[model samples]
Target: MRILGLVFAGTSTPDRSQMADFLGDTLGLPRVEVGGVEADLFELPDGSTFAVASPGGMGAPRSVGFLVDDLDAAAADLREAGVEVGPIGENERERYLHFRAPDRELYELTERKAGIA
Candidate 1:
């Protein structure tokens, strides 16, 4: 399946309060929560979204995320092609997975949870 678009730049920060200030108070991006993850998400003029999520790691470089049509199918395809794929994580409203590229860049793929609007 084709990627829908770049979804987010996720970072692993020990604490997000200051990061929140930087992203919201400084950068002026609105903060919102989706599927239990608190993040700053806003739509660009071109209709693409920019999001930032907090993690437990400190001062790490951000990771890239993408909106995919089908998380399960895509993982299966990647596994079949001998790629190192992560297990899909699901919550009540979201399904996502993380994996590394040939160059070792971090990436995450996500989709709306089944039965979710």
Candidate 2:
């Protein structure tokens, strides 16, 4: 599977343009827009896109969310591959299933709705 982006848990939703400018001017990185979400798509000279978003609000930083292409298929594949799947929260809009990597980092597979911008 292709990694669309890397989600970071930030304290607040910082000014998108300002952040983009800082990355472009100071860090010399390229920015890209994904579904109206402004992100420093190329930072650290690496190909990974950095997706910054505030979790729950200003002070509730939680987990990183990965936007996946196929929610159900990914979740099923994980389960069939012998991974433990977490409960799916329907009201959360996106379909999610969580699993822990060998390093104990919590990884979530999420399939977001299209045109959610």
Candidate 3:
């Protein structure tokens, strides 16, 4: 499985509103609204995303997503190698899955929907 780039990074906090404010107001990242999820989504200049949300929103306290060209093949390869992979997650714009690393940290593999940059 070949990774193309870094797609996203997110962290959870108990104070979601304050963190959201800090990210948008202080950092000046462009805030976006994502339906069906309770989080403040910010789009970086490079088109990657950063999210700040309440604890438990993403199933991990902190996580990063790597862009992949083939989500299914990546998942298969990781599973064959005995990696602890979570279920596939889909939204309007992407498909993704979380996996546990050897160090027990959770990370994600993401495939952007066709026509999306």
Model 2 TM-score? 0.47
Per residue, candidate 3 scores C-alpha lDDT tens digits across 5-82 of 998999999988898888899999999776655678999999899998788988899999999999999999999999
- TM-scores, all candidates, are 0.74, 0.47, 0.95
lDDT, candidates in the order shown? 0.68, 0.53, 0.91
**Candidate 2: tens digits of C-alpha lDDT, residues 39-106:** 23443443334444443332223345566777777777778887777876432234556676666666
Ranking by lDDT: 3, 1, 2
Clashing pairs in 3: none
Off by over 4 Å in 1: 38-60, 114-117
lDDT-best of 2 and 3: 3
Task: Return the top candidate by TM-score.
Answer: 3
* Candidate ranking (TM-score, best to worst): 3, 1, 2
The residue-by-residue lDDT of candidate 1 on 16-115, one tens digit each, is 6677678778877766555555555554554344555567331235677787889888898778888898778775556888888798877878786567
